[model samples]
Target: MSENWRLDPDRALPADAEIRKQARAIYDEIASLPLVSMHGHVDVDLFAANKPFRNPADLLIVPDHYLVRMLVSQGYTPAELGVPFTDNGGTVAGAEASDVETDSRVIWRRFCENWRLFRGTPTRYWLEHEFAEVFGLSAPPSAENADDLYDELTAALARPEFRPLALLDSMNVEILATTDSALAELDSHAELARTLGPDRIVPTFRPDSLLHVRHQSWAKEIAQLAEVSGIATDDYAGYIRALEQRRRAFVAAGARATDHGHVSADTTPLARTEAERIYTAALRGEATAAEADAFSAHMLFEMARMSTDDGLVMQLHPGVLRNHNARIHEKYGADKGFDIPTRVEFTRSLQPMLEEFGLSHDFRCIVFTTDETVYSRELAPLAGAYPSLRLGAPWWFLDSPEQMRRFRESAIETAGFYNTSGFVDDTRAFASIPARHDLARRIDAGYLGKLVAEGRLGPDEACETAIDLTYNLPRHAYARHERNA
Candidate 1:
């Protein structure tokens, strides 16, 4: 363990003395404000059961793709990191099931031994915050203290104060939105509604599987959606109707938005007959790749139309090439952190959808991309012009401090502050939520302080802008769901 371990109160603030002083004052104003988690992947069932985490490894290392990917990149296999293997006879390359580590203590030690690998990364910052603020650990993780820390966490997690709902209250989270599939029953969400009350844990509709007709399991998922919605989906029109019904169910269950994870931002609508033909081919398991892409693009347009009618905000996260590592995917399943970003173009791709609903008062779309090149050249200009479009915060691979600064510098000139959605921690690791949000708030304070120091913005204006970026903007962007809840 590093004996010098300590988190500086002014970390990530401006380095200059005067600017750091200004930034610290701004940070203090919003540091304790209720967190509005507008987007995340935390499982609602954890709250439904209010169960203690199984172990330190299960809680920290297993589900976090960010950590798992880093460990794997450094020559550690997924099996060594305690990642569960698929039950359907999947095996890692050049490794056998017998080699997999099953003891939580062993995995924890391995992680501590390699703790230095996380230096200078956001993962290190988040882990430090979680270790000190969340878990109240006095020392940093090291090979010598791994077992002791693991035991401490295990005991702490067993207490009622550390239960899911109790921890949420302690964290001062006002709202948390979870991503759910279109075919999901949402029974856990319903349980959370009764346990935690309405809007505490809202669900967001995710239809990525349904949109990609070329996926091997598309037909199976369609059948599941039909069963859940009680609407036949054998034809194109029926599929649309089924999706609409699911959206209604989501709204009734306190959903405020629909999330799309597309490979590109293509939203060109196909002619009705062509859409039907593609749907028919997909149903027959014969749709070509080109046809599937066309169908997915058209479905994006249809989703926007549905959002306009239902009043659910639409969030588009495009440009990720998911499952880029076939070997890992075939061995461990999706979300192994093999997804990579590709160059994306939004101007021409979104023209059809934007032309249709860009001026609609009821329609709202928040676009996110890992490709930072589009922030200034395309996204900022598009958001500046469209009443319904807003740029999403830096996400996925770009959710680091340096990238966040670059994002603000590039996009804020054109889109201004209001045309951007506030920070949303798109995290699956529940404990990391506060840490991630804290990082964003500190970064925003530093950025705003610089503006005030440079005389570009008044101190009062900077403070108000900081508040909006931290609180008001997220509430406004997700207002419909908050109102419905």
Candidate 2:
């Protein structure tokens, strides 16, 4: 009782004496399993530096959008949460709190005083889990104990075992696929492999920086890609060649998949001549906004073609209306929880690509969307039909117990469990990896428990599904997509 409020055991099971016990058994089993993180944006630089964390607040609260957004909802601005600032150049600078005591203990005290704000949120559960299980903090975080907790965590962080590399090892992460740019050199990953042996910290090629037509640095970015890949970038043909070259570089750097994020699922496989024309316009920086969008659509199809040839698993996470808050974009740059969901229609938007490559057995694609309405309406049906297509786990805004359960309920009936890729944390925060996966596994086990109780599945079958969802399925999904790299 001194630790934290007991939420329903395993996250959201009803708090009946018998049900709670059943859920606890399931949670304990899953929680103790090794972490499998196939998607995340944790800074590789942190591992490379291998430095002790600066402080508790910096480690726990500052970098997490989940924490910042929750506080923001309660009248804490991003600036107040120490979110760095950006001034239209997409560069962040300046601290939010001015001249106040900037020590780690002070910041931790701020969080502790307001700990009640997180009372019923998933954020509370995650924070408590990390504080209690990882850092060995038995007492709940409050102003009275804030400094003590901070001192303990800070001391722990100074130890050799608390370094990022050592922490990953301690957590027993079998495989960690880190998100990276297609144009990235991946020297860090290479160095890490050389130092620690292979297949530990693998790179994932995220080409969204190349595909975002709205990027202010789009032309400069293309040039950088060309320079990195040693490919000419004078025209559309040159652009494609440069992208392919970079893709090869990423593959050599231990990437087996290519990730794309578009504003919508709209895809077009246009005639080569039209593509060249669009490329010419973009090269000259003379294309209208509409043409740029159509060009992006065309590029999606081209990317699929490249994936087909190269055998890299293609992951498409489209349909996010990014940076909905113009003021925030003006202040904090992108990926600060300013992105909002938009209506998406994949059936019509993806028909061109599906018509061309969806049935191909050699190609593999995982499609993710924020638009849950399309689970039954488009994604599951499409996945059910297309050999190349597999549904990605619920992502970004929907990575919660309720959302995971809802996803299983909606998608399992149409696409079946086999047609979908198992869960990926898809988080940027490194420490949240185990907590996120724990939540997913617990929710999955609880869901299976209901099915077993309802007679839809025997307990034996439910156990198999639980294990698959927890472990084997993700391995198969990645292996199917030729993710051996």
For each candidate in turn, the TM-score is 0.97, 0.92
Q: What lDDT score goes with residue 154 in model 2?
A: 87
Q: How many Å off is the CA of 44 in candidate 1? A: 1.3
What overall lDDT goes with each candidate model? 0.90, 0.77
Q: Clashes in candidate 1: how many?
A: 0
Q: Check candidate 1 and list the clashing pairs.
A: none
**Local lDDT at 412 for model 1:** 95
Model 1's lDDT to the true fold? Answer: 0.90
lDDT of 2 by residue, 291-321 (tens): 7788889888888888887777888898888
TM-score of model number 2: 0.92
Model 1 TM-score (2 dp): 0.97
Best by lDDT: 1
The residue ranges of model 1 lying beyond 4 angstroms of the native Cα positions read 1-6, 89-98, 481-485
